[model samples]
Target: MKPTITITYCPKCGWLLRSSYMATELLTTFADELNGVLLKPAETAGEFCISIDGEPLVDRKAAGGFPEITALKRLVRDRVAPDKSLGHSDRVHAKPDSGKDEK
Candidate 1:
């Protein structure tokens, strides 16, 4: 069974747009893997979280910050489509060790 993704955002914190954006992005990105994406208004103030089938994926309070878009996608992709590629998101972001090459 495909997993249902849920984003709970704090209205007081003005995170509704953020939640909506994630829902849209996830829907488009994981159309083949996800069952549905739900945007829920959080009861607690300043609370924003993402869960898949009730399993916490992004716990803002616990993490002390929101998850980066790539990290969040990685988490979901790992659960839903482990074999799927996330294009640029899946690619490692790095630069060569310039000083080491210079001797």
Candidate 2:
């Protein structure tokens, strides 16, 4: 069975828009793999978390901040479609190290 992704965000903290945006991105990216993305309004203040099938994938409090969209997509892709490629999103941002002489 396909897995469901849930984004729980604190409504009081004005995180609903953020959560909804994430849900849209996940749904679009994982249309073939995910059953759906659920936007859950968190009861706890300042709470924001993403999970797959009730298993926590990331917690804002623990991570100290919200994850970038690219990072979040990579995390979800890893679990839902391990063999899938993320194209530009998967590209490393840092320049590659060149062992050869640069002179």
Candidate 3:
């Protein structure tokens, strides 16, 4: 399953925004509030970026809506947690060091 919510931070201003929502609960709630416009599930992890005009509804300091945020947090956590059995290595290979003459 895809994430219900995706967020991004601005490198310059440190502002955060809602990037996407794919989870059924959040999207369905949002759609219902919008009078029945449904958001389809992604075929292969598509993006759902959006801009916030004002302050973020949720942030590092505190969660805004306790219930909704908690649900979404649980969903995101489940989606991002690495599977230990997968034995995935996160290391990146470094380029070979070049002699000064090669510069």
Candidate 4:
């Protein structure tokens, strides 16, 4: 069974659209893997977090900003669709390996 994905954002902070957009992205990407994606309004000021089955996955307060979409998708995919490929999302944007000689 797929886990429920929940994204809570500050409605008063005018982040409703952001939250909705994430929900849609997750739904579209994990349509067959997720039970559903929920967009919730945060009661506390400056609160934005994503959880899976009630487990905190992303917390803006702790991480100091919104999460990147690719990172979020990876988290969700791990729990809900382990075998599913995230295509471009799987690409690592990490800094170049120090061993690689610069041009």
- Which candidate leads the pack in lDDT? 2
Error of 2 at 72 (Å): 0.5
- Candidate 3 regions exceeding 4 Å error are 1-6, 9-23, 34-53, 62-103
Count of clashes, each model: 0, 0, 1, 0
lDDT of 3 at 103: 40
Per-residue accuracy of model 4 over 5-75 as CA lDDT, tens digit each: 88889988999898988898899999888899888888998899999989999999999988888888998
The local distance difference test score of each candidate is: 0.91, 0.92, 0.33, 0.89
Span of 10 residues, lowest total lDDT, candidate 2 = 94-103
**What does the lDDT read for residue 70 in candidate 2?**
92
* Comparing 2 and 4 on TM-score, the stronger one: 2
For each candidate in turn, the TM-score is 0.91, 0.90, 0.22, 0.87
Clashing pairs in 1: none
Q: For residues 1-103, could you state the per-residue lDDT of candidate 3 as single tens digits?
A: 2223334333343222222232344454343222221232322232222212222334432443223444443333333442312112223458888755744
Q: lDDT for model 4, on a 0 to 1 scale?
A: 0.89
lDDT of 2 by residue, 41-70 (tens): 888899999999999999999999999999
- The parts of candidate 2 lying over 4 Å away from their true place are 96-103
State the lDDT at 9 in candidate 3: 38
How far does residue 78 in candidate 4 sit from its true spot (Å)?
1.2
- lDDT per residue for candidate 1 within 18-38, as digits (tens), equals 888888889999998999999
Off by over 4 Å in 4: 94-103
**Whole-model lDDT, candidate 2?**
0.92
